[model samples]
Target: MKSLDIMIVDTPYCFAPEKLRKLLKWFFLAYIQTLT
Candidate 1:
């Protein structure tokens, strides 16, 4: 999770789509909550 945070922060613009990154971040947290 810490690595993921760093990835999100340091990843360059051309490497990933900003909107998808944000959507994935939201879904990742929601999925974790659903598991517990």
Candidate 2:
């Protein structure tokens, strides 16, 4: 949890809404791939 929090904060998109949306889209895609 701590590492995840750190990662999010360290992200260049942390304060950018457009980049954040793209980030979440890719994140979900990666997560779905893992499940498959």
Question: Top lDDT: which candidate number?
Answer: 1
Please name the candidate that would achieve the greatest TM-score relative to the true structure.
Answer: 2
- What is the Å distance of residue 34 in model 1 from its true position? 0.5
Give stretches of model 2 more than 4 Å off.
Answer: 1-16
Instruction: Tell me the tens digit of each residue's lDDT in model 1 across 1-36.
Output: 666567556766366688977776786687678679
Q: What TM-score does each of the candidates earn?
A: 0.51, 0.53
Writing each residue's lDDT as its tens digit, candidate 2 over 7-36 gives: 655776646689676876687577668678
What does the lDDT read for residue 33 in candidate 1? 87
- Evaluate all candidate structures by whole-model CA lDDT and list the values in order: 0.69, 0.66
Report the Cα lDDT for residue 10, model 1: 74
Cα shift from native, residue 1, model 1 (Å): 19
**Residue pairs in candidate 1 whose N, alpha carbon or C atoms collide under 3 angstroms:** none
